[model samples]
Target: MANVEFETLAALLEREGALPSDRALALLREATRTLSDVHAAAILHCDLSPATLLLSSDGRVLLAESALARRLGEARQPDTPATERIAAPLYYPPEAAQGLPLDARTDLFLLGATFYHAMTGAPPFDGEDPETRALQYIRHEVPPLEQRVPGTPVLLNVLMQKLLRRDPAERYQSAAELLEAVERTERMLQKRQEARRAPAAAGAAATDTPRHGKRPRARQSTAPAEAPAERPPTTRRAPAKAPLWQSKPLLYGGAAAALALATLIALLSRGGDSKPQATKPPEAPSTASAVAPANTPTATARKETPRPVVEPPKPKPKPKTSTAAPPREEDTPPKPQDPPEVTPRRWKAVQGAAAGTETYEEFLKRTKGIEVVDYEDYVVNWEYAGPYRDPACAEKCGPFDNEFPPEKPGEKPDWAPLPKGADAGRPWLFNFRNITQIAQVAADRAAIYLRTRVYSAIERDVQIWAGSDDSIKIWLNGQIVHSNRRDRAVRPDEDRKDVKLRQGWNDLMVKIGQGNGEWGFCLRFRTRDGEKVEELRADPAGK
Candidate 1:
């Protein structure tokens, strides 16, 4: 195995006792959703313990040994309490004992349990004896997360409750669902923190506008002083009574929302107008923004609180006049609206690209696959099965080749259009945000195809760096360029080869094969000394 350049998450947590909830929340939420995406590709991660969740030195999460994670539809050994495979038994569901099918929900339960353990300093159903813990798990008898950790966010606590539910039907159906809640909670927490920094004097301006013509205004303290010291830090965060996303109902989209945008727009206008009394009392305290927290708490760091700030008086309102005057620059209230942040782009490869599984012994003669002719762009498929989302193979095959029944003649087989899968004539488009299991259904054999692209670039010395789980064969401009057949894990640029290209559109085709484990390939252009060959353009679809 190649040396992984990070430590386990458990080590980080052990090193860092308590972290600021936001820092910890962002890391956990993002990582959990990534694992969900992996499962969406039909891989099962039996090891969801903290040790398998690795943290890079710079604080990013990287999954290790996913190649070893079990594939869905593969037969698993019968289960016994002692024979169960999860490294940490406490992070699993009762289905392990009940002999029920494990799906994405299983991982959802584990993710919630992992977060609960991190926050409360104990597993949700901890006990002195293994028997007691298992019994509690089977009975759905874990303590509510909020009771264990008094200051936890309401959304998180409720989410954890649903996640740890004993009945799988009651749990989140997918990581996508869990991730939606996570992102909403993260944003709510951030918005609450920002709300805390609003100066108290700003309330006076709001108070001046009467909801009813005769409503009395709240009196601002003439002699302002610092806030009291004994307050709990969490008090500034208002009760998250409503999911803010609900405020913009149009996003949900229905006949009910025909009035939502217009109604919300009016409410916002009124909120901007003279009705501070209605808005100020429920206004979450804003003094917390006095200063930034000491540092972003990491897994190994203690949780840090913001220092209190002294509130400055907001400028008193100017007298109303018939002759309007231009508003003073400082007189403008800072908008509660925050600027949206941009996320960095990550690598994307199309997931389903399997042609058909070919028996290793018969692949040379029996298999119907692609062979490059002029190499401008051409896609070939099995004559019997045609292009299909699921493949029909002759024997047991790897997960990458397990989507369909083995090939059969005169058997009008069941087939469906490949979802976001490539089509014949048009090179199967295989673009996605991460490495994915492209296609499946053969065994002890090879399913081979070529991904040919026409590129426009200056005539120069260039290189192709590729990484694949299976050995890869590459042809550059109709010449035999490079071939390597070895068992290796998929990574960026596991191998590189120098190639020559013409100034006009140049041609390249890659032939990929399947190995026992996960199978796919990563290919990109780079200069001889190693710069992304950004000047080249490629149309793999030949359109």
Candidate 2:
């Protein structure tokens, strides 16, 4: 089967208009159930909005774009502004916008905001601009759903109000509790609809009853007297007082007698007798008498020897026997197996000891056969510094203010030659290197520095492609080449800069800042013509 493409709930709302209360509640229940699972795992979806809620054609609801998710107890970086940390400020709760510590209820508030928009076709918090909208989340109360979209279910409106509560304590404490309320509201709406249809159905049934009852009586009165004889004595007996006009046998006999009397009178009149002798009219039985005898034999026969009801024979149970052949193994049903769980790829630590220090001759030997030095090949080794933080610095911190600053690129820092210690700086080698996954630092709200040296055979212009989780600044040969202070998820090639790589080894330094959630950065070098650079070598430990 081909994979199905899903559209976001935001797109659905735009094309089809706001969802009805029942439909909205059903989708909310599905979304909340998924949130409950995430909460159980001690994770929080820091970003929740209509654009992040995926809707499939098959009616499946899924949460997407979870790069902003953080651990339950994780706190935002003290130095990082809350505005830079949130993916969607319109959906952020008061506590989140204030840069305070968050829990499961933080996500619940966002979930409510997203669904409130799903039902009302607009976010609960509104302002003329993004800044104003974010402020609304902190300072203003959300307007009631029913007030915005009249005729919305009262229970649904009340539920939404609770979800959008300004204080975490007022909102549902857990996703489980929210899911239960959503389900209850859904059931109540269904019952109300069923109740509405009940009376209409009953009225229709009432009108049909009398119209149907007259049919059987009409069929019985007009039927021929012999009609009952066709059935077995045990099945039927003719009616005793069928109308005389309705009985065929009685009507036929009466007509014949009237004709005979007419003919006799005509003969007597022709003889001219003053007083004609009374003619005997043919005899005709009464309607009851005619119908009674026809049915009397059947009634008497029914009482004398009623037809026997032959009951169908009951099926006999098969006797258990060891002589029966056993089923073949191939014919037996296979047991069902669960689908394998797919885990997201995470950075793994490189193994094996570092190759001590290599001479300048060794670096040449390593690059002798290598024609091209792509981004990955250029990232062989790096010296990582503290997962540092300064609340006042935020995204504005520079090399001059940090603990250790290299005078120039490619040159070893003064701290590098210091005696080995826990806090001492040293070169770290990577067997499997992705610049973005280089340092798997435990802290989220902090900054880190990575410096490496690259040897180029000759001068050439190259394009640098870089991406970062939040903020990043790059230096080539101790000269700043690129800087982006805004926070965002890492997407390779999000930033590009052109620079010259002079002959011999040159220093390259990168400083990345993390606001919250995931943290990382990626860098690669491509020739001006978009081709990979050749005859280059990476030297992390200056020889």
TM-score against truth, every candidate? 0.37, 0.37
Error of 1 at 319 (Å): 62
For candidate 1, the TM-score is 0.37
Candidate 1 C-alpha lDDT tens digits along 382-477: 112222222333322222333223222354543322233242443333221121333334322354444445454368887877766555666676
Full-model lDDT, candidate 1? 0.55
Q: What is the C-alpha local distance difference test score of each model?
A: 0.55, 0.67
Give the C-alpha miss distance for residue 514 in model 1, angstroms: 55
* Error in Å for residue 271 of model 2: 99
CA displacement after TM-score superposition, residue 353 of candidate 2 (Å): 90
Q: Which residue runs does candidate 2 get wrong by more than 4 Å?
A: 82-85, 200-543
In candidate 1, what residue range of length 10 has the lowest lDDT sum?
A: 343-352
